[model samples]
Target: MLQIYNTLSRSKQLFKPIVPGKVKMYVCGMTVYDFCHIGHARVMIVFDMVVRWLRASGYEVIYVRNITDIDDKIINRAIENGEPISALTKRFIDAMHADSDELGLMHPDQEPRATDYIAKMQGMIGKLIENELAYQADDGDVNFAVRLFPNYGSLSGKSLDELNAGERVVISGGKRDPLDFALWKSAKPEEPVDTRWKSPWGEGRPGWHIECSAMSCELLGEHFDIHGGGADLQFPHHENEIAQSEGALYGKDRKLEDAPFVNYWMHNGHIRVNEEKMSKSLGNFFLIRDVLKSFDPEVLRFFMLKAHYRSPINYSDAQLEEARAGLVRLYTALAQVTLSQAVKAELTDLQNPWVMRFTQAMNDDFNTPEAIAVLFDLASEVNRTQGDEKLVLASTLQSLGGVLNFLQRDPTSFLQSGTKDEEGLCPAMIDEQIAARVAAKNAKDFAQADSIRKALLAQGIVLEDKPGGITEWRRA
Candidate 1:
């Protein structure tokens, strides 16, 4: 049985799906105005690990990560570039997929785009207005009545008074309360024609909070097993979702306990730079593609998992290089072993102590750090053993890593393909150099062999001489 930390409850609880043997999960996905950054990468990898674990545990998982394809950012970027909103969003969407593919992310079962569910959003907003939970402001914008919803700040654990005190300069639109958020934004005269929709609230578009509420309810019903996002969304965005969704579901008589929108609320912590939150405004955020230029995609994935999901992970080149070294060690153990039929059969023996420990670690709040430690333990055993048993250990290591989408690449290729200077010295060139080194050693020319090793090492290539005069190399 898996236990996950529910942000709403503020403690770890046993996971029980609303439907037995099945899970319905909704995660707030990317706002595709630009390329995804490392912060976004954490969200993608964290939930992906959760879904993979659920399915591996014999539960059918229905994962839905919604895309915010029609947000204010998307609209502004389209106008700035003088392109259609669709064109701007499509490029980022494609880029997101490419980034996920490189990071070895499993696609969500359903990726509901915000634009695709405009009608549903409008219908839900109408329900709110009919119930008096939402009202069309004097400016024609529709805003949720936060005061009417008694449990408005429950998710964020802040009272209305606290929120008011902490509030920054409020946007003085037509909102009755400073804390009240938009359900529908009235269109502006200067806005592009494509940005507006013919809504009941006039020619306007759905607000960011309303889009998720509508799409999640329409796709996964009014209530679902898990709702997750980054910690930054815990305040207004997710809190607003809970208010609007429940308000529409149970009307003005809604109580927090009466009808819940989500059972378990999970939020992964942020990625920081030098203990500061990574953000574009700070100029500290690193794009996924930018980081990929230097580090392997899997290395980035591993770096994110090195910390517990709820803990803030600091990003640095040194940290990534350390993660790369750790990954190299795991791959090295599996290099010589093959997944034979007998080895595959051995994996089914779940009673194996190492497998049991791995499962236990994963079950305890998806403790990937401990689970990853188990992999290192297994790797050590694989290194110390030989023959058929070693093959079984190697196969077991790969199988467990597959659950987290790691260690599946061909070991030899993974090891050799990570050379820092791919263009300067291709794999063939490295092999030729290694061949020369070997020939020098065979001729007892120690000086020449040492010189060759030094040159490769200077180029960020590490060479390991095996017992049988074989040399293995990887990027440093």
Candidate 2:
């Protein structure tokens, strides 16, 4: 049995899928106006880990992560670049996928783009309007009446008074109430022609918050098992999703039901840099490719899983270097043993203490930090054992790592390659230095050999002189 921390309930609860052996989950995905930052990567990796663990736990999971292709940000970026909206969105979408692939993320079972779900959004909006939970404003935009939805602030755990206290006095933007949010926005003259669509509320596009509700309902049905996103979205975005989705009536039932729209809500904490949240305004924003220039993609992945998904993770060079060293130790252990391919099949055996511990850690709210400690333990066991027993333990280590999408590479290759340092020698240059050191040693020029070894070591390369005159090298 597995338990997960449901943000809606504010506590960890036993996971009971709507369908006993099946799970249908929807996660709010990237808004493709720009390159994905570390924050975006965390959401992708966190939910992907959830999906992986659920499937590993013998549940059939239908994972849907929707793309917001028609947001104001996307339109503005396209206009700034003097490109078509489709072209701008496609470019970023490809970049996003490239980033996801580099970070070793699994493709969602269905990635529904918001632009494709316009009609579904309109349909939902229509239902909200009919239920009097929504109305077309004087400006031709349709807005959800937040005050009318009695449970509007429940998802965010804020009372209307508390939410009202934070409201600023500004032009209401044609909203009847300051707290009301747009379900459909009427297009302006300056906006691109393609950005608008013919709808009952005149010509406009769907709002940001409504996109998830429409896509999730249309693809995963009226109600699903899980809905997730970043912690930043918990307030206005996810809270509005709950209002629109739960506030509407569906099927033969013409009244709002008591049943919740989503059974469980999950949110991953933010990524912080230098004791502050990573944001562009602070000038500390990092793009995924930019960070990958210095560290291996797997190292970044390992760094993320080193912290509990619900906890904020700080990003710095020191943290990443520590992650690389930890990953190298695991790979180093694997390199020392010859493993049998069939040994991985024994992962389900509860008799294995390591497997039992790893399973327990993962089952308790996907506590990856604790689960990763089990990997370190297994690696130590592999190092302490010998012959066939060592091989079995090493193989089991690889198998368990696979459940979390780690340690699938050849250990030798992973150890020798992957890390990047601009000031350090390239692979060919390092090999040349090693060959020179080897030649010097063979000629009995001990002083020159020591000098060469020292030079390479200074440049972040470690050399291991092995049996049969073989030299092994890896980045330090």
Q: Estimate each model's TM-score.
A: 0.94, 0.94
Cα lDDT for residue 364, model 2?
A: 94
Clash list (residue pairs), candidate 1: none
Summarize candidate 1's per-residue lDDT along 376-455 as a digit string, tens digits: 99999999999888988888898888888889888878877662434656778888999999999899999999999999
Off by over 4 Å in 1: 164-170, 255-257, 345-350, 419-424
What lDDT tens digits, residue by residue, belong to model 2 across residues 1-476? 69999998899999999989999999999999999999998999899999999998889999999899998888999899989999999999999999999898999999999999999999999989988899888888898888888777777788987875121122356888888888999999999998999998899999888999999989988878999998988888888898899877532232544567899999999899988988877889889988888888889989998999999999998999999999999998888876544368354788988889999999999999999999999999988998888888898899899888889888888887755656667788988988898899889999999999999888778888878889988777
Clash count, predicted structure 2 = 0
RMSD of 2: 2.5
Please list the residue runs of candidate 2 whose C-alpha ends up more than 4 Å from where it truly belongs after superposition. 164-173, 250-257, 340-342, 440-448
- Cα-based lDDT for every prediction: 0.87, 0.87
